[model samples]
Target: MGFDWSAAAGTLEVVPALERLELLAEPVASAILQLDDERIGVAEIDPELADTAAFCEQYGSPLELSANCVVVAGKRAGEVRYAACLVLATIRADVNGVVKRQLDVRKASFASMDDAVERTGMAYGGITPFGLPGDWPILVDAEVAAARAVVVGSGLRRGKLIVPGEVLAELANAEVIEGLGR
Candidate 1:
């Protein structure tokens, strides 16, 4: 059966993400239009509850159904590389291990909040993989890609996106990596 967004929505109302572009960051809205995927939906929420734990608690959503997209920065010699790691909120991304190796860098760490926000053109708590720079790789944990449906940031503090996991697997720059989250 398809995901029952209504049941999982708690007191929030969900509508087609494409139909509510005003609620998303510009890049995210454009990406959603380009993807033209109908299964994506958006729900408005209080900005104060944008963080994973608080959002899930306030919305009555399962923790397992939430995904976090973290921006990582790695430096090799004089060059810096960026990647987005998508993993289940219940676990942390293996930033210094698998991701570091994958990026082929000496050190890997989460980008500074200011840097991440500036680079992604999104709010501090709302950076999402959907609208990341085209040149940056997106590392999606296998478990997240296999989930039925997941709640992710909408590139805006006041909203969230509901999407089928397979859609993330199909993004052009996405790589499904096993054990990306640990």
Candidate 2:
């Protein structure tokens, strides 16, 4: 089925425990003013597309497409100190050694849907680096900064926010890092 943003907009219900806020609408561009903090801007797009290239082609705006990757430490049976990484669509996160070293955990792994949603207060497939816990390290791919704007999650599953890269960095308190290769 094609992405129906209007339909998604209709399902804006506040999740009780997470208290995560959601905004539903067309593909936003540069600055999600609705967010009071103005940290990261969100963009709405198809969740089915697994790769950034596909998302870019479909949206006709590669510069605005970013991949929000959540890296957890306790994914291997049992662990803790989960971390999330937000990178530009043009690059991939270093899920192996780099992420492990950055998070300073004995082992780092991708978080499960339940863990991600519970920790970040965002829905599965709808998590954004914005508004995440301050203790969580937010890393941005250097390439994302080069773009005039970048697209990130809207704290919801349906729509996305396209906002300035600087704004996202400011909001997430993200640190610009390298090693997002392949």
Candidate 3:
């Protein structure tokens, strides 16, 4: 089933933005389409509201209906390893605790904005877990995976994606973690 964008995003229409999905970052668009999940919907939004709080408030969506994907980096045996952390807007990713432990690294920190934007090929405020690098493990919080539908970035500031929470859990390399969000 598709997302009811009229109710979730207020006036936004659910369109076949995925038909032109290449407009999104290459990785994200490919994942969504290739994953074979039919509960995904795409919609446009004002770039100004791309940030979670602004997007949720402006679109009349609750914080719980939004998920934030952050890029994190750490070093293990002198090799840098990066991963994507997905959590609801209502909670924070346990980066230093659960995340570091999960990565089996001594230290973990959010990637710098320049690194995140340049490497991911997505705007700083518009990074989504869907299009992350192949080697990056997508760490999804249990609560986020339990939601019926979630509003996430479209890999650009001008749009957003609506997908079933279970779909997020099914991404390649996705690791659904309990206590990942705090």
Q: Candidate 3: where is the Cα deviation over 4 Å? A: 1-7, 20-23
User: Per-residue lDDT for 88-141 in model 2, tens only?
Assistant: 655667867777777766666688778777777666665666556667777766
Clashes per candidate, residues 3 or more apart or on different chains: 0, 8, 1
Residue 66, candidate 2: how far off, in angstroms? 2.8
Per-residue lDDT of 110 in model 3: 99
For residues 38-129, what per-residue lDDT tens digits would candidate 3 score against the true structure? 56778878888789888777878878878999999999999988999999999999999999998889999999999998878888888998
lDDT score for candidate 2 against the true structure: 0.54
Task: Report the number of the highest-lDDT candidate.
Answer: 1
What is the Cα-based lDDT of residue 173 in candidate 3? 90
Better of 2 and 3 by lDDT: 3
- Model 1 TM-score (2 dp): 0.96
Superposed Cα deviation of residue 85, candidate 2 (Å): 0.6
- Of 1 and 2, which scores higher on TM-score? 1
Best by TM-score: 1
Instruction: Flag clash pairs in model 3.
Output: 28-131
TM-score of each model, paired residue for residue? 0.96, 0.66, 0.92
Distance from true position, residue 151, model 3, in Å?
0.7
